[model samples]
Target: MAGRWVKPEVFPLFAAVGAVVGLCSMQLVRNICTNPEVRVTKENRSAGVLQNFEEGEKYAQHGLRKYVRGRRPEVMPNLNKFFSDPK
Candidate 1:
């Protein structure tokens, strides 16, 4: 007697739960294939920008060190120094 289906309301409840789960799973699959959260190209572009910034920082540090040491003049010497006719 206890094994018999005694509650009719449970059928509709189960049906509603199944429909909700099906719709949610479909939406999840659609979102995964159509609209990703992260883009590889954008990440690579940002990484390139960061790398360029770091290189510029290193160059600036070298310039500052050279200036503090007073080893070189502000204006670089002419390239002709290497190719000039013998004195």
Candidate 2:
């Protein structure tokens, strides 16, 4: 009979670690492809340091930050609003 190379108990831990690594790698690839600051075009290469710094600052606002900019500061917005409402 063939011997078991890996124990069954450690499978879930391996899966979780793989998932985290995959997510991070995908995010990095997405940023590399979409983020202008990371790309060096002919115009960008010729620009001065101050211009590059300003451009970096302009693109530094990530998608998540833009999404949350208008959101209320609450852990559970709907639940909190429901309970806090005066009847």
- What's the TM-score of every candidate structure? 0.35, 0.48
Tell me the tens digit of each residue's lDDT in model 1 across 1-87.
754655786788878989999999986775554333322565554654343556455544664576668554534446555566476
Stretches of candidate 2 exceeding 4 Å from the true structure: 1-19, 30-51
Report, for all candidates in order, the number of backbone clashes. Answer: 0, 0
Report per-prediction Cα RMSD to one decimal.
28.6, 4.7
For candidate 2, the lDDT comes to 0.75
lDDT per residue for candidate 2 within 1-87, as digits (tens), equals 224637788789889999999999998996787665565577755664444555466567777889999998899988998999987
Q: How high is the CA lDDT of each candidate model?
A: 0.59, 0.75
Judged by lDDT, which candidate is best?
Answer: 2
What's the C-alpha lDDT at position 85 in model 2? 96
In angstroms, the error of model 1 at 15 is 0.7
